[model samples]
Target: MTGGAGYIGSHVVRAFQQAGIPPVVLDDLSSGHRGFVPADVPFVHGSILDVPLVARTLAEHDVTGVVHLAGFKYAGVSVDRPLHTYEQNVTGTANLLTAMADQGVEAIVFSSSAAVYGTPDVDLVTEATATTPESPYGESKLIGEWLLRDQGRATGLRHTSLRYFNVVGSGTPDLYDTSPHNLFPLVLDALTQGRTPRINGTDYPTPDGTCVRDYIHVADLADAHVAAARALGEGRTLEPVYNLGSGDGVSVRQIMTAMADATGIAFEPDVAPPRPGDPARIVASGELAARDLGWRMTHTLADMVSSAWEARRAH
Candidate 1:
């Protein structure tokens, strides 16, 4: 699995391990911590862009498939560094595909993002939703999907992409989301550093006057990835993409409340001005994934917050 040492990737690695599958990890450790990988798992410290290295690792492990989660993932930052995003997401994906083809690894489960939908005009996003990505990061992910589709046509590569919104919580206390830009880590960092957790744009059109988003637990998302990989291995016909989302949504205000309760913090969050281009709400229907990939909201809002808080504190 590429990037198996990172946040979501590490959780997926553990899921694979729990299923009696030992995975070899290839990570550059850019934003990933080496400790996130288990001491028993074979770890290769390298980037997917290193085509020779990836091919060698695949051959060494006799890998049958790939779980790709490595990339430049910050949507906001991608706007200012479009070239860097393409290098990491687009070009890096192309290199991984090349290595896979070279090593005869014909299956992959791509860790895509809901950013491909951008600001959807519909009430609920689905597999058929029009893709009009607003940032370089989203565009790169969309292009990565295109790469897989094109490769499938040419080389019969079996592939599927999992699109998701905010991923929260940890499956175990030993792992946590450490991205400086992600919500759970940001809020937890603020609280840990003796600063107030602030909520941006609390006057949206939602019931609680904050932006609403689909927040799925990382463990549930990891399960879906494993299921997708198994489906590919079994030659099951699967959709090209699946959205791992909450049918309903949770507001930022709700998240703040949960954080306070979970952390035993008494202070209310400070309301700040809305970030530019911040949508009032973005939620999707996970019905397709539920039907095909065993996707479901296995964790409640409180579960998401409390589990994430526990992991962050342990870290």
Candidate 2:
């Protein structure tokens, strides 16, 4: 699995292990942590852009499939680092595909993002929703999916892209979202440091006047990857893309309330002006994934908040 040491990737790696499918991790440790990988798991420290390296790793491990999660993932930062983002996400994905083809590794599960929809006008996004990415990060993810689609046609590669919503919480106390830009880490960090956690915007046309987003548990998200991999391995025809979402929306205010209750920090969040291109609401329907991959939200808002808090405090 490429980027198997990342926050989401690490959890996916663990899921694969629990399913009795041994995984080999290839990570550059750019945004991922070396410690996230298990001690016994095979770890290769390298970038996926190195086609030869990837091919060599696949052959060495006799890897039958790939779980790709490595890329430049910051949507806001990608605006300033467009070239960097394209090189890492687009070029890197192309290289990974080349390596996979060279090694005859026919199956792959891509870690895509809901950002491909940008700010949709609908209340619920699905696989059929039009893709109108507004950031380089989102554009790169869409391009990655395109790469897989084109490659599948050309090489008969079995592939599926999982479009993730806002993934949060911890599968275990040792694994947590460490992204500096993520809301959970930011909120938890501020409270731990005796500062007020600030909400980006609170004037959106929602019930709480804050932006609403689909939040799914990381553990649940990881299980979906395993399911997708298993389906492909069993020669089952799967959808090209599936949204790993909860078909529900959680506002920023609700998150703040959850954080306060979870951490015993009762202070209200500070408000800030809306960021550019910030979507008011971007929920999604996971009906397709549920039917195929048994995708479901096993964790509640309280579970997400408390688990993240416990993991953050642990580290």
* TM-score to true structure, per model: 0.98, 0.98
Q: Estimate, for each residue in 1-315, the C-alpha lDDT of model 2 and write its tens digit.
A: 999999999999999999999999999999999999999999999999999999999999999999999998999999999999999999999999999998899999999999999889888999999999999999999999999999999989999999988899999999989899999999999999999999888888999899999999999999999999999999999999999887887999999999999999899888899988787999999999999987787999999999999999899
lDDT of 1 by residue, 193-289 (tens): 8899888997888898899999999999899988999999999989999998898899988888899899998778888899988889899999999
lDDT of 2 at 216: 94
- Deviation (Å) of 169 in candidate 2: 0.7
lDDT of 1: 0.93
- Local accuracy by lDDT, each model: 0.93, 0.94
List all candidate RMSDs to the true structure.
Answer: 0.9, 0.9
